[model samples]
Target: MRLRTLLRSSSAVVLAPLLAGLVVLLLRADGTLHPVPGYGLSVLTAAHSALPYIAAACAGSAAWEGGRLKQGRVFEQAPARGRLGIALPVLAPVWLMGLGGYAVALVMAAVAADGTAPDLSRPPIPAVAALLLLAATLTGYLAGLVLPRLAAGPVALVGAFWVMAFPASWQTPWPRHLVGNPITGCCGVGQAVAPDTLWAAGIFTAAACAAALLTAHRATVGTAVTAVAVLALGTTLAAGFGQRMGYDGTVPRAAAELACDASARPRVCLWPETPGRTAVVAQIRTETGRLGAAGVPVPAALTQDPAGGPDTGVLGRTGELSPEEVTRTTAAALLPAPLGCEQPAREPLLGWLTAVATGEPPSDARVRAVLEQPRAAQSEWFRAGRDSLTDCGRSGVR
Candidate 1:
């Protein structure tokens, strides 16, 4: 069969409108779009989350195409191409159609970001969708070869949907993270898809596709045995990759790697998408200086350090923080409340710090009383309360 003839087939015609409708529905349900930075990633995440439905449709369409081949008795006609050659023409356009859907979807997602350019780092999500389409289509083809088309089409669609959707609810990491349910919307301006997780999923889905191809092309017992062995090996290898979650926690490291502004004192750095970084940095520095002047220890640098631990006093997630919010949060960090204390008096130093950060006088009577105490008494209050506070009452800064 000529490529042109196959391209003009009924399968492509039917799938065109179906895919368009599905994509439209997905866009409508994609919820409100925030105008924060990393607009590209948020759009990609929405697209990634819709893959199971797209893949389900692909599986059904592929099964129908397979049935058409078997029903026409293409094998008996013995066209110029053998079984594999004939099947290739029937399958290629549909697979390409599925890939085309992702391309169109990527464009729509970019538009949905409301003028913000999405990160074009080529996330592994589209590749994952492509591999899943191949796996589902090939599996459907194998079924179509055995069962009648009427039964195979629906079965493959439902089965593929279940395979993709059910694992999302699984508690185990292998099924939850590796089973194709996207850990999407987690990647923001400063975050990325976990490379190890993406690689493992790619390996797993590729193995499944290969096995389906082998089963559809070779019916021999040896081929079947080999396919099962390959699948098992792939599964074992994927399991050993040790991915704890489907997506990595967002880190400011990606932003730090980008162009950093060092003009501010204490040299505050931020992600490109971080709103009002200079203002927030200035406010934080001022608040930290106030803390220091009040005899409270403050970190010299106020930056987002990916590797910094709790004691490092790292200011984080500047994209979400306002300038005043940063001031308050930084003040709290400099003089944090003790946990689980039964002390009756409010911690005067912390109240004063909060008052200074927010430009408000301390209102509570106990806090007011504590502020009137001598400097030594206030110091003793700070130290004594630190030990007396249990794990529950963390801060008395209100």
Candidate 2:
């Protein structure tokens, strides 16, 4: 079939509305990407966000095409082309339509990042997404060959969505990782998509596509056996690899050169993509100075980099930098780091420290009582609270 004819007749003609919907979804979903505009993160997020919709559309369209082929007896007629050749041309438009949607998503991500260059160090999420979509298309086409024409499209549509979406809710974290969803918690500036996650998705989707193709082409018995063995091996490896990843399929990103303001007493460092650095640095300096005057020990440096020392305080990784945000981060920095174990007794002290750092009155009655004491007495109590923060056994407030 000619390219023009295939496009005109294929479901790609009606995909405009779907693509438009995808664009809207991309824009709305990209709000979190705005603060950290790393291209690799943006691209990965866009691909995962767009996957469910694009996969459903591709699968449904391919199913319809498959039904049409079956109804026309294309397979039975022994046409000039073989089964694989005939199906490929018919399904080409659907596959290309899906790819077009992914392209649009990438463009939107780039736009969201204000055209920042991609972090090339990160895994190839977009490529993995393309492979995953190809597997979905083939799976749907296979469904059409077996089911009644009226049932194939709807079945493929629902099944594709379920496969892409349902795993996210599973108690077992690995299943979601194996699917093309990537990771939702992915990619603060300090994080990257785990390489194992990409490998798992790639392996599974590639295996699925190969199996579907072999079946569609009517392989010999020996070929079928080989394909099944390969499929099983791929599944085992993908699942094992995915199980080892964190729930969100991310890892601490490798260190990169940061933008730092060295003029301040405690140097302030941030990701290069962070906006309004001058304002952020000023706020940090002002807040830290106030805390120091109040007898709180300030760190030697404030950095947003994940690899910074325990003594170094961290700034917020997302959102616009503001005075309130700076004050909160600075105050929290003065406190002991969370031990992950609960320490409810520390709430009053935490509240008091935050109030002092921000120059706000304490809201809690217990904290207010502490503030009413003389400056020397209050400092004693504050020092005790800071020192005992990690002592979970000390349930009584000082």
- Cα lDDT tens digits for candidate 2, 1-398: 78888878887668746765766575667353442565367455644666777888889888988899899998878766788998998887788888888677656656666675444355467678888789889989988988999999999989998998888888888878778565545666666678888888899888888988987787479767877887898889899889887467877655564787889778888766566768878877876787678777788888776566856876645445567666676667667766666666567766876777677897799889988888788778877777767776655366
**C-alpha lDDT values of all predictions:** 0.65, 0.75
Q: Write the per-residue lDDT of candidate 1 for residues 271-340, one digit (tens) a residue.
A: 6556666576667767766656556666545545545444445554546786656765565455434344
Off by more than 4 A, model 1: 30-36, 246-255, 258-260, 309-312, 316-318, 335-352, 362-366, 374-398
TM-scores of all models? Answer: 0.83, 0.82
